[model samples]
Target: MNYRHAYHAGNPADVIKHAVLAFVIEHLLKKEAPIRIVDTHAGIGRYDLTSDAAERTGEWVEGIGRLWGKPLPAALEALVGPYLDVVARLNPDGRLRFYPGSPDIARLMTRPGDGITACELHPEDGASLAALYARDRRIKVIDRDGWLVPKAFLPPKERRGLVLIDPPFEERGDYDRLVEALGAGHRRWATGIFLLWYPVKDPVAVKRFHAMIAGLGLAKCLTVEAIWRPVDGERLAGAGLVIVNAPFTLAAACRAAERPLWEALGVANGRLGVTGDAA
Candidate 1:
C-alpha cells in the first residue's frame, strides 16, 4: 500500500519494462484478431513527470530524458521505437511532460477491438486509473488485490492476449507469490502470453527464482535482464523481465537492445544479458 510509482515512473526500470511491453504489444497486434491486455498492479495509467513527487526523485532525467529526440542505430531504434513514439504522441509540444504507464501504452497501441483490464490495489491509484479512462469503452479499471486477478481474469474471452503481472515488491515472499500466480494463470490459459517484471536487487534471489521458473518446464520462456549499476548489496538498480511465450522476434529484439540500452543510460562497469529461448 505504500508503493507509489509516480516517483519512479520513467526511471530506468520503467524505461526497460515499458519498452519491452510496447514491443510485445506491437508484435501481438500483427495477427488479425482482437486481444486483451490485463495489467495487475497498474498505477495511474499515465504520469506527470513535472509533479512534486517526480521532481523530488528526478529519476526520469536519467531514464527517458536521455532518449527523447535522439537518434539511434536503425536496428535498436526499431526495437524501442514503439515506446518512444507513444511518449512523443503524448508530448506534442516537443517536451517530455507526460509518460505512459503499461495501461496507457496498451491503450495507445491497441486497436478499437482490443480490450484492456487495468487493476490497482492502492485506493488512490486505482481511482486515478479509473478516472484516466472513464469514458473509454475499451478499458476497464478494477480496484482489487492484484495477486488474485490472474485467477479471476485469466483466459480472456478474446483467447489471444497478454497478462502482465508487474507487482510492487513491498512485502516479503513476492517471488514465491509470483511463481504461484503465474502457475495458476497458466493453468487457466495455457496459450496466453505472460509477462512478469521483477527488480534485480538480490542476485542470489534472482538466480533461485530463475531456477524455480525453469523447474516449471514452460515450453517457451525467456528472461531479459539489464543492469546499469554496480553490484551493490540488495540495492535495486537494474530490471528483469520473465516473458512467457515471447515471440522469437521479440526476444531477439530485446537482446539486441540489452547492450545498447545499457550504453544509452550512460554508464560503465554494468552488464546486460538475455537468457532462455523461444520458438
Candidate 2:
C-alpha cells in the first residue's frame, strides 16, 4: 500500500503498458457486444504532469515527453493512435501536462453500455478515482484489495471484457500472488482477457514469474516485454505484460509499436519480445 503512481505516471513503462492496453481495447471494440473492464490497482483516474511528484522525477522526459508532438510511422501510429487520441483529448490545448491512467484509457475506449469497475486499495487514490467517475453511470469504483477483484468480480455479467491486474509489488510474494490470482480468475472466467503488468528490475525474478505462469498451461497466454536498458542493480530497466487469452492481432500490434517506442524513448539497446502460445 505504500506505492503511489503519481511519481511514475508517464514513465516509459506507462507508455508501453498503456499503448498495448489501448490496442487490446481497440480489438475488443471490433465486436458489437457490450464489454466490461476491471482495473485492479487502479490509480487516480488521471495525473497532472506538472504535479510535484512528476516534476521531481522528470521521468516523463524519457517517456511521453519524447512522443508528445512527433509524427509516428504508419505501423506505430496504428498501434498507439487510440492511446494518443485519449491523451490528446485530455490535453486539448496541445500541451502535455496531463496523463491518463489505465482506468482512464479504458473509460475513453469503451462505448455506451460498456462499463468499468476500478478497484483501488489506497484510500486517497480510491477516493480520487471515485470522484473522477462519480457522475458517469458506466463506471463503478470500488475500495478493496485489487487481488480480490478477480474472485469477486470475475465472469462479469457481460461475459466479455478485460481484467487488468497492476499491483504495486511493494510487498513480498506479490509475484506469487499474481500467479495465484490469475489461476483463480481463469478458473472463474476462462474466456475473459487478463492483462498483468509487472516491473522488470531483476531478470531472474522475471524468469521465475514467467515459468510459474507457463506452468499454469493456459492456452494463448503471451508475454510481451520491452527492455529499455540492461537489467543491472535495483533500478527498473523496463516493464512487461503477461496477457492471457490475448487476441490474435495483439502480437503484431505490439511488434509494430516497439521500434518507434524505443526510438522515441532514446533507448539504444531496447528489445521487444513476444513469448508463449501467442507468439
Candidate 3:
C-alpha cells in the first residue's frame, strides 16, 4: 500500500470520521453489557507529527491544528470531547505533536471486559501496531487483511460491538469489494453495527455507493458525508461514512458537528452537509 496514514493523520476527513467514531463508542458505554470493537484496515496506533512523513504532508494544519484550542460550538464540542481529550493527552502542551489512528481510538476507550481486534496489512504498520499495544490484554493486533478477518471473527465474542471497515481505496475495485465485505460481514453478524468509510472522488462513484446500500433494502442504514469543496473531477475533495444499524444519537450528533468542523477546516470554496436515515 502506497498510502501511509502518517502523512494524512488528523486531516479534516480523519477529524470527522474519528469524531463520529468516538461518539459511537461513547454511546456504547451506556449499556451494561460487554462490547467489542473490530477494526478492519487499522493503521498504526499512533504517529509522531514531527516525523518526516507527517511533516512533509502537514495535513493536520487544516485539520486538528485549525481548532485545537479554539472554542467549539457547545453541541459539537460535547460530541467531540472524548476524541479531543485523547488528542490532548497525546499532546499535553497542546502543540499537536502526536496523532492517533482509529485503532488507538478504539484502544483508548476499551474497558476492562471490553475487547478489540485490529487488523493491519502493511508489514511496517502492522509491526508497529503490534508493538504499540503489546501489553494491553483487552486489545488484539493481527497482521492480515481486515476484510477476510471479519469473516472469521464475526458476531464478536461479546455479541455486542461495532465493526469498522476503513480500507485504503488505492484500488478501483475497492468499491465492489466493500459491497461484498459488507454483505458477507452482515450475514455472519446480522445485528452487529458496521461502519464503512469511503472517499468521494467521482460523483458517479458516490451515487453508485448510495444506490448499492439503498438497494440492500436494509432498514436502518445511514450515509453521512462532509464535502470540503465541490468535486473537480480530479483529486479527492471529500469523503463519507456509511453506517449500518447506526444508533439514533449519531444522526443528531453528526448534524451538530458538520458546520463547526467545516468552518474550521473547509477551504474558501468548500461546502458541508450530513444526511441519512436512521431510527
TM-score of each: 0.97, 0.97, 0.95
- The residue ranges of model 1 lying beyond 4 angstroms of the native Cα positions read none
Candidate 2's displacement at residue 241, Å, is 0.1
As for candidate 3, its clashing pairs are none
Q: Give candidate 1's whole-model lDDT.
A: 0.87
Q: Rate the local accuracy (lDDT) of all candidates.
A: 0.87, 0.89, 0.83
Model 3 bad stretches (over 4 Å)? none
Superior by lDDT: candidate 2 or candidate 3: 2
lDDT of 1 by residue, 1-279 (tens): 799999998988898889889989998899989999999889999999999989999999889988887887666775789999999999999989999999999999999999999999898999999999999999989999888987799889999989999989887578888888888998999888899988888888888888889888898888888888765756786888898888788767876776677678786756667888764
Query: What residue pairs clash in candidate 1, if any at all?
Result: none
- Candidate 2's C-alpha runs over 4 A off are none
Clashing pairs in 2: none
lDDT digits (tens) for residues 1-279 of candidate 3: 897898899888898888878878887888989999999899998988889998899888888888798877786775688888878878888677888889888877768989999999999999999999999989899998887965789978799889989989998778777888888888888888888899988889888888887777777788778788778768887988888888887787777766666676746755545566675
